[model samples]
Target: MALWILCLLVVLGMGFNMVSGQGEDPFGPEGGRRREMVPAMFIFGDSLIDNGNNNDLPSFAKANYFPYGIDFNGGPTGRFSNGYTMVDEIAELLGLPLIPAYSEASGDQVLHGVNYASAAAGILDITGRNFVGRIPFDQQIRNFQNTLDQITDNLGAVDAAQALARCIFFVGMGSNDYLNNYLMPNYPTRNQYNGQQYADLLVQQYTQQLKTLYNLGARKFVLAGLGRMGCIPSILAQSTAGSCSEEVNQLVLPFNANVKAMLNSLNVNLPGARFIYIEIAHLFEDLIANSKIYGFSVVNRACCGIGRNRGQITCLPFQTPCENRDQYVFWDAFHPTEKVNIIMARKAFNGDTSIVYPMNIEQLANIDIEPN
Candidate 1:
């Protein structure tokens, strides 16, 4: 019965892609004129999208060793995947080069953008204390403010604001606020509030942080919602039968719901703010359910990890990973493979309203903001 359901989902997915013209290559024709969709792309979040930001941080959450980034151009560049991250693909689709990490970005590089995401970072400042040295969301904002100051120093306040107004502020946060803090045994968050209350608390803080970005000159926003956290290798490994923890899955819905509502409210309240929500959870669930159609043969295990489902421990240094990395959905206990990232990024870039609510990244980029 489950097999039949999965087959049905694949059929539906294929048909939807065909109708939506999503099957076409997004990189454009060879030697074609490549036009940038936005002036710059400022990124924030945790390891799922962190390129090399956490490499220098004294944190256990770091992934600067072998078996990580095995498929990328520069091997082991602190990405928690075998190859490209979602944002990397998004940058390519937008006709821009890869956005450098804030720690490494310098000189004229700041004109394109910087990624401030850190491994184990979360919406709450104290959420990733277990990792030590992880930069929380608030601190990431401050880092961006510093970047903005440098840009303003070079371009002057009015010109900097004009350039920033045309940039894309891509934020994908809150996963660790659950995986590392609320759900961890050492944390007291679980006992402090119920699921709904915890979600409300996170979004409330999130709203202020985003508004701070807006006040600092961000006008176009692409807010990525959390994926199916319970289905990740780490959470699945916790089950005796290697099944997804439905309880963990249920815990995050309130957060996604509150985030969607918050983005909608921000759109109407904040002038010139065009905030869109990426249905990441929905897209991930689809990919997992219809794995075969998407060319993923292993949906439950990591390509490079230890123990049952290769999930008991994350990928280690110099470990031999599965050769057929493209067939796996995950590269580690918690992060998706480059293949999955590519699919997700492409969808968010050009997918219809069902995947990216209010508007897609392409639409958001094309929106012209009146100078203030």
Candidate 2:
């Protein structure tokens, strides 16, 4: 009887060990089992979520150097922010690992998803020509196609198509199209189109681009609208008082409105489409208006740049960022710190209706979809 009892006790202990050693799932809540909300995430945008895609590109906008990633675990990885970007935070909330840049991703890395964003890129191909080398939205889409082809080769056409339809395509382009193209005095875009006309042109082009993505098996999309461009440190620095340029803000308002309307049209036109529009401008205005509530003391200044508001020049090599990085909203002339990124991502993922409309990322990820 004693021997039988010992054997039973040992078996119970082994079973307990096995359960404990299985580890908690990173996809679920803390100490919960791992489960993927979506099959993967395919990111497309500009500097806001470039990750390391621009590192190897012959672009002056690259950030894979010192002082850029001081707060990130892996160091400067071509992300404009000091740490993670909004997408990085969103990926964490979705229970996935950091999405690799398309420039460096290969084989299985493409399965989890890939970041095709390039710093200084815009919806228009000619937008960032001054940057010398940047992958525009068109090329980024092509890169994604190549990735899709590889996935198809690996998993067969049917499986690859199904996997892609279940993934999330997060797009945050167009800001540079305005800032780096239309608003830049050196560019002729402004000459060709007025503010409203330019907005219309962008929407026309963007509408077609999104349709291309839909055709490529992207069913779930999180399209981030443009933030207040005039409020960023770079634009504010243009003012002696370091105040936001209301005119610039007005310039992009129509674009944001058009984008939201376009998404609505797309949802109706495309079958099985689930599009979530992130009200970035509204969220940004709220954070700026209630900085103290968000624990930010300085929203007008860049944490690591030169001149007034740190907006005159971007973070140069070896530039020492402010000691209290989290207290500042702007990481450089244009980007947000990791803390701000986290806040924005969290809000976009699961915040109330004001920040994210037509359902948040969490909702978009979990919604039922027919297999493609």
Candidate 3:
């Protein structure tokens, strides 16, 4: 028997917000529901999926800083994108409300789960732009551990254990490590290591970090590999005469492939640990190859700034934004629009064992499993 459940969360952004049960939104009853699902979700990763762990961190991508959350909760929460991320969508699809920011760590946020992801974080200790002062994935793990301890202090250990097992732990970062270490030549970390060596260190760090989360009582996880970072407008600007850069793709493909291999190896060695890969290769490539199919009209250009270093230097208070943000694939050079994240989340949530690996988030949540 298939046990599935679905949840809905309706966030109202400016013009892009879609009514529930219809239109472009992923969680609002448009996609079929799941039954007996995980009660909550937690996320850890970069800008592509952060839900404002950068709230207290000092950085430019800080979503909790200002008009950022003008739409959602009336204050910025450091989410980076326009609105919503894979974590938000999945939480909605699981029949739960949006998991509160980890800093909002009340038993209230713990009702479903809490988001521990910081925008500049990576799988290793050395990722993210220097000007941006990254919160390394290991340090983020420390925050998660503290969050657990706080929960234990309040909810006790058994509840915390159940929370760890029944909730979907989403990991969607690590791109910045490569980006800062290899792509952007100006960083000190890049000058310190060759591409081959840095990539090797990155994978090793990712392996150990995932292990750390497991040791902390996280049982189910969704690991999203790097997508086509080469195709982003920022990279394209730096390419041969403003064209799509194949060199960036070179870095992405091998890194993502290795991530898959690492996950497989982890499954073989770690008992009771379940995981799924988000297939970022196909997802981003599909968006690039067929933009309209993904409902994006301007796939190559950013909806935010004037291009080039728009991924970083833009998002100013004076720059003009596009009229129809829903049609665009990107909000900034590096981050996807809310619409794009919704689709990605839908793809992730709807994935079965065949696509995601061992068990879907639903099953991993222990919503329905064969008796032991």
Candidate 4:
């Protein structure tokens, strides 16, 4: 009985290590710099990962204001969260510097990376029309192509292809397609197709979008799947019972599943492709299910919004957020707290197949691909 109990305890410890990292820091010893895992990391996504790409655009999804960056070093650089984003944390783990937004990047900054992620961006062109001036996924891809053109100009085609082949392309999209398009009463997406049909359509377009990036010399890819949208503060605010809307949760499952299958197919079909999927939905589910274990006390309300559940609207310009920001699961109506982002990023960096599929970011970065 004693031996059996010890074995059970060891198994439980391993599981916890998988969820929360194994306490390994990718950063090296004190006073010494570790070599970056990849040459650069290009980001493509929406508000969840948008550093400041939408600040200049005439869009309602901007977050360049007080309280938004209260916890960050430089105040409110247009990140939608209180501090670092998941991509930011991932960048640090890869030993790369914080990538600048494409709108702000210039000169040698492009050598490291450029974030083309924009607030309210989506898989479909018209997904965020309500926000007006927001860049969609297709436009973001064009922006990447523009960056590639400049890289080729500087390094020449051969060196540019080799450099890009070693860089990591991190793409997190599709959230806004549901949040601001299909789910919105003002949009015609729901009327045009049901949930399953819409998922297929989005995945079809998404596959092509990824292929374009691949053709442009991207070899390593980290595609983040959509999370549990129903539990977000915005969706919860619409719930009459102050609980998660199962219908909303059910609506996004097909999209995640289809994306996973798509990634597998891409890896097999696309030459030199190393595509990995991040289980955002499963991570969110585990975090919410074991909130206390993760130190999140407030899971249902926003830390800085107005109206019911503090989610009727996102944070106002100078609104003061909760004092215990780290204890809250969400920072605003549609985004997770920086703490949650940290957890997700760390898991993706070193966790097993359960969190990041086929292989983790650390493994992906270390992959030795022959120049093609």
TM-scores of the models, in the given order? Answer: 0.90, 0.90, 0.81, 0.91
Candidate 1 residues 1-372, lDDT tens each? Answer: 121121111111111112243333222344363766665688999999998888888889888888898899989898999999999999888877788888887544544567899999999999889889898999999987764565355445665566667778899999999999999999988999999999999999999999999998788999999988998999889888999999999999999999999998998999888999999998998898899999999999999889888899989899999999999999999999999999999999999998999999999888988546
lDDT of 3: 0.65
Reference-based lDDT, residue 89, model 1 = 95
Off by over 4 Å in 3: 1-36, 64-76, 150-159, 191-193, 307-312, 352-355, 366-372
Q: Which is the winner by lDDT between candidate 1 and candidate 2?
A: 1
lDDT of 3 at 116: 69
| lDDT for each candidate structure | 0.84, 0.83, 0.65, 0.85
lDDT of 4 by residue, 106-212 (tens): 64354457799999999999998899989999999998786567535544566556666777899999999999999999998999999999999999999999999
Ranking by lDDT: 4, 1, 2, 3
Worst 10 residues of 1 by lDDT: 4-13
User: Which pairs of residues collide in model 4?
Assistant: none
Model 4 alpha-carbon drift over 4 Å, by segment:
1-32
Name the lDDT value of residue 370 in candidate 4: 51
Error of 4 at 102 (Å): 0.6
Highest-scoring model, lDDT: 4
lDDT of 4: 0.85
